[model samples]
Target chain A: MSDDKAGASPAAAYLAIDWGTTNRRVYVMAADGSVLATARDDRGIKSVEAGCWADELAGIRARFGDLPAIAAGMVGSTRGWREIPYVIAPAGVTELATGIGRIPEERFFIVPGVAYDTPDHADVMRGEEVQAVGACLSGLAPHDALFCQPGTHNKWIGLKDARITSVTTALTGELFALLRDHSILAEMMTGPVEDGPAFRAGIADAAGGDLLSRLFGVRASVLLGRRAREDGAAYTSGLLIGADVAAREVAGRLVHILSDPNLGPLYAVAIEAFGGTSTAIDGQAAFVAGIHHIWSMIDD
Target chain B: MSDDKAGASPAAAYLAIDWGTTNRRVYVMAADGSVLATARDDRGIKSVEAGCWADELAGIRARFGDLPAIAAGMVGSTRGWREIPYVIAPAGVTELATGIGRIPEERFFIVPGVAYDTPDHADVMRGEEVQAVGACLSGLAPHDALFCQPGTHNKWIGLKDARITSVTTALTGELFALLRDHSILAEMMTGPVEDGPAFRAGIADAAGGDLLSRLFGVRASVLLGRRAREDGAAYTSGLLIGADVAAREVAGRLVHILSDPNLGPLYAVAIEAFGGTSTAIDGQAAFVAGIHHIWSMIDD
Candidate 1:
């Protein structure tokens, strides 16, 4: 089971896992960095009971063979399978590799998340660091660039000289979901969120006032009959994303966006609307690539 | 039963009701503006079953005796008993009184909410208008001042020459609750929210960036051990209210805050922290006074 053994089978491959809050994606890769097999499950760290992660990993190994395993994302956080200290930025794959936490029983290693500790704002990211590293390894990222990972907790990372130098996080997506599902505005949003005029109007509204005030317009617009109730979701989405993008320093920069297909289009639209050029990178591809690169850095 | 009878009993009084989304407060007042008796129930407009508001009112009357009742807040909203149109500002007691919609079967009148319609932002308020008017009649408001009503939907009303000239709203309270109960940050928060250093630190964090970015710090601070998890609620509250207050144009103005006792102290702390002076007014007292002033303006 241990890769350090004197003689290993030819079928042995590295297992790269991105264990996040909601999903766990596993990549089986050969020594030359080509993917051999893959598996995924909804048993994210949030779903696993405490002290049961070892059994969960054993279950995965039962199906995919007990190859040397490396994991990233929330799996390294205190809430995850095991705690790995955050390697403070500016850090890249080398520094991150040095901070890897290990599980002796299963030959498993966890890549540390990165943190930016400053007087103004403090930010941290886990899986995104792997994605950023992957983007760099794949030549999708520039030596100096702004990378955006939009999701529940959207991150705007500043990369320089192939290292993550700075990080900022926005709770835009989470806030939007909270409002859509729990706030008074939920009643007004009854249909699918369309990318139309109402969405743009929400973006425009973000520029007028603070987000706390601007959000109220979602309900007011419907009550006034100015907007259909069905448009509430799109409009709310635009307002949150628009405000988030506007607050960034991306007026004339090429922002590299790593997002799932569902969120990528919306981010691209907002980035363009805010006077920035955006390149959408597939999230899963970047995650796999990043995990693979990290696994290669480990010595047998 | 009716106040309009040719020879009415001496105990007949005007009943003022402030029926909001979560709570219902009834104030029985004499013609001279003194509170005779009061009652409260959790049966807000939201809790009342559809087509049963009349029965609810009858239940209140059955206990307190039939009287000409005037109601405000969400009870007059589209989802309430009957939809009363908003009276656009700049408006005061006269404009609000003129827009009152009557329920003929029950001898009930509902005061209209106020709306601000501009190209930039649209805002609507139902119960806060009653609070604003009450503050004015009670001589708690200055001729030109900012009135802060802190609750689920906190309203900041701009009063000029004894009339509500402008209005702004912040979803601070609502957003705080949603995040505390539903969002990822909820797990970090467990104890009652205290007004302490953590709360002030959160307010300071709010002054640094957009709300979307600042909110993420709540989780990061706890995760990094920079702040205790129990402090999450207070910190989040401070961040929300601080961001809201910081965005307003009320640095030097005297702000009259009409709020329930629980939230009033927090707003006072935030208002003072943001370099503005604030006066706390009892919400129930204001509602009763506001409804009395509007009722007295009615032409019999």
Candidate 2:
């Protein structure tokens, strides 16, 4: 059966864009988040301009044809194409649509990102709010969600019911990038690595206690001749993740990690901390879900 | 009558040389490591022609007259003048003098350093070993000792009695340097800081656990405005140190720290970790004691 709408055959082709500092991706989803035709562009928010963002969107149109779409990430913020205002977390579906915009080709809504007025400074979320919204819609989100997103800038966000309430970011990926690649941790490492049991051992060490000292141990382990150079980087990777888990020490919370698997070995560690109740969503999936949420809000 | 030799006054003057990768200093001591006439020279091992090392001694003679002297640091190693072999820990007076070297008219012995030879690589300590040797001389040293020397490359040496047994180095200072002056942590920091209570609070955080997560909190605190940038550095500093202490939780071991008084705030944090039972030695005094150890070995 050909479901046609708006003078075209319809597959419920909904478009989603997850754009950030260095990478950009676009996906065509069904009414559900099942990816249809996916396309990507290298010109992320940092490298491209809001005016140029349309050009990247053109790439998606070529793959899936003209369709209704929703966007997330910097795509919706003040720096983005339409400057979608942020919705303070704990906002409802109505608040989520406050800053959504109208795209020329399709009826699109830019999801309202989340923010908080912290004591010292205001903490804001752009692309991540979409993920929380997606999680809420996926029916996978736990009651009190402790979202752990590990990446270049790892974030741990909390959601009550279906709204993001609090969030924190960790420069674990950047720190690891520095120590293993730039600092003495590089010396302990061999260039191409298979990561001996040391990665596991490091995870154990981080779990044993002394997260920061153990983190420092990256240099000390190299200096002490306990680990090789290439392994040192892996050790540092484990150190930060282990420390993250060790620090959070979440016993009963339904911890959810929204991050790239390639970023670090944090997902496994988070699972170890939060136990069987832990759920991990791929960065791409959460992003798509976030887009669907914004699209759903646009019609409302 | 004290080693009375015809017309000879008791060796009233003693010389000490501290030479390392980038800096060298000559100190004229009153046979007790007390500074008398001190001359700081720029020519370190990396900069000096080894053949000129003898001339450098003559230059010392020109500054403080003819005097018996002792040399510490890398000066005695293969990198410096006449290679002084390493002495395994539990080093004694006789074992130390076995590596003695004398320039005509100057009585001296270069202190033997220590090294750890493992399967992959070995770490050799040239100067720190001397300090550990000095630490061994103290009457308080037990069969097993834990020495903490805080600096750019913090050293934590584990000794079995008199012999310098095993050791580890923490890049605590280096991390602080990188974070405060070079990395992301610098972004939040402003002007000079007293650190104050934030320092202790950071330590307390490490003690609380989740070192990796706590480290992330350093950047979060500042970025979120929970802490002042200057205080962020201070807080991060304490967190790193506290993580180290909390990680190395040895219940009954005697913990002794060799550090400059300038690190008083950090020392206060260390005291909080190791407890008041932890004893601290002045870094300057340890330098003197180290040189004395080398000299006594020579004279004996």
Candidate 3:
């Protein structure tokens, strides 16, 4: 059904918002947690004027008639519409839902991200916590599992008994993009995102040695005419993902990869090359499912 | 002595040219290997128009007469004035000199870079091979040693029997520049290029884990208020260098770091932090000495 028609229905339930730095997605769900309609726009938290989050929520309410809304992602960041304190790990949906911060007068609340503190370092994640929660609730994740959410910041998370115990962020995708666009290696790469032999070769190359030294091979191989120029992108992708997987030492473990469509296959291939098995989950569906799960946990 | 005065001297020995991608330096040397005068400009190989190598050499000849000139670095690459095929390692000054490509009638020749081949990978170095030869001839490098020439591409060379046996290129410096100027971490950094505790901390952080994950800590630490934004550059440098050192497993060994003044101290510090000792050699002096050494080996 159309969003307006769903909004007009007496059965219209709750509004779920996945609000990140670059895009905003809203889902209309019935009381039973099934999505009825969805809407999205480029008005991410970064583009919204400061102190205007309330007004922005008001506009959304105007269309959906004041349905109670729950938001996730960077919308709760310092640079976002509001700054919500992080819920420390090992934390589950209950802790995350309980940490939600409400707008002063609106029927809107923001989901708090999860943070982990090790003896040597600390890490924090915003929207991915929602995805983790969704994965657990949707039964895609096991009681004890390793989850990899690959994107600009690829996160490898350790979950136990539905609680996120650890989080590690890899700058794989960002580094790949940076090198592809700016590094000397950029001159050699051809398009259509290479995937077969060149990519597997990259993964194999990443199996040993320090990544700092290995990265230069991308340029060196092409310059030496040892590898085809068209294979540059795949080689780079394999190198990054391979290094990441190797560092994690995920051998023999089943890794659940939650990634956008484009990156899912690459991570899966790399994981297998590194002696691990992985299953890919749709990121957007997991994101929406996560929001719905968290929204259901919040008390009126 | 002034360049013109030295050019007029009958005692003028030979010419040494260190031509890289961004800058070019020419040295007039006495027969005894002392530098009589030096000149430099931004007219590196990259700036020189195609087929203009002869014109460029002629302009220098007009100023310095018919003194035989030996050039090294990017000037011999495909993009340079002439393409000199790489001399395979285990190679030394004599081998490099023998591979020098001459310009038809001009008293000028280009030094060939050294290349290393492994069953799995290939690597090549141009100007630094000259410095490696210089380091050996100058007695700064041991018969068997690990040499690090730090710059855009940091080369870790294994020298034995006065020959470069192995070559590993680390893109540490280039990666640092990319992140410092373009990544999200750039917004948080204020620099005088940090060199103290933060740098050491970054090195320590790199001791374990993949670089892809460790790099993200630079941003997360700042956002979490654990580190000052100003320390970002040092932290990044430490992370890259530390990862490089740790990966090489160079503990307890003496590393000869041939670097420009600015990068020398930083590397020395990182090496010490990682349980190794290092000696910093001036890169430019080494370059000129390398050119002279190779030139002396060329037959009349």
Provide the TM-score of chain B versus the true chain B for each model in turn: 0.93, 0.76, 0.94
Off by over 4 Å in 1: A1-12, B1-12
- Each candidate's fnat, listed in order, reads 0.82, 0.38, 0.86
User: What TM-score does chain B of candidate 2 reach?
Assistant: 0.76
lDDT of 3 at B74: 94
Tens digits of lDDT, candidate 2, B17-96: 77776787666666664555555667778776868877777766666666666777778756687676666544544556
State the DockQ of every prediction: 0.71, 0.26, 0.77
What's the candidate order when arranged by decreasing lDDT? 3, 1, 2
The TM-score values for the models, in the order shown, are 0.92, 0.74, 0.95
Better of 1 and 3 by DockQ: 3
Residue B24 displacement (Å), model 1: 2.4
Error of 3 at B159 (Å): 1.7
Q: Over the stretch A1-300, how does candidate 2's per-residue lDDT look in tens digits?
A: 121222232664666777776677767667765666565667677776656766766655655567666777776655567776667667645577766666755455566666665543245667877776667667657545778777766777787777777766666676667666556556665543223465556666766664444555565456444676667656666666665665565765557767555643445554564452466666566666656666665653
lDDT of each: 0.82, 0.63, 0.82
TM-score, cand. 3: 0.95
